[model samples]
Target: MTNATRISATLPPDLAAFLDEYQETHHLSSRSAALAEAVRALRDQNLQEAYQELGEAQRSGQETYPDDNLDGLENE
Candidate 1:
């Protein structure tokens, strides 16, 4: 299975033009691949920020996950 699905999106004309140029410039297989790469990049960025927040909370001696409220949770 390719794990692919077709979805429709409404993009502004300017943004749509930009995506087309970006896809051509990067030689992506398709616009879907370009959008997927953009989504992956954003996902990685969000994960990085979340990890940084966890690290900061740990440094400040704050409970990233409160043990008192956690039920059926394993910390292994």
Candidate 2:
């Protein structure tokens, strides 16, 4: 946490309220921490989906591979 940057953002009322509630419930120091956790969760979800797809392709003998960055095929 030696380096940090500040940015401004706007959110819908519902989303803003959710962040506030999540911060308080999780005992996060700030809404920024809550938002960071949300983003990390999303990244984890995307990775999980990509790995599932890769496993499925392997099981089905599709012989296709996911991209290096795990973006997978766009047309699927």
Tell me the tens digit of each residue's lDDT in model 1 across 4-34. 7788999999988988998999999888988
Tens-digit per-residue lDDT, 6-69, candidate 2: 8788999999999999999999999989988997789779878878987999899897773655
Q: After superposition, how far is residue 17 of candidate 1 from its true place, in Å?
A: 1.1
- Off-target runs (Cα >4 Å) in candidate 1 are 65-76
| Pairs with backbone N, CA or C atoms under 3 Å apart (clashes), candidate 1 | none
Candidate No. with top TM-score: 1
Model 1 alpha-carbon miss at residue 19, Å: 0.8
Q: What are the lDDT scores of the predictions, listed in order?
A: 0.79, 0.83
Residue-pair clashes per prediction, in order, are 0, 0
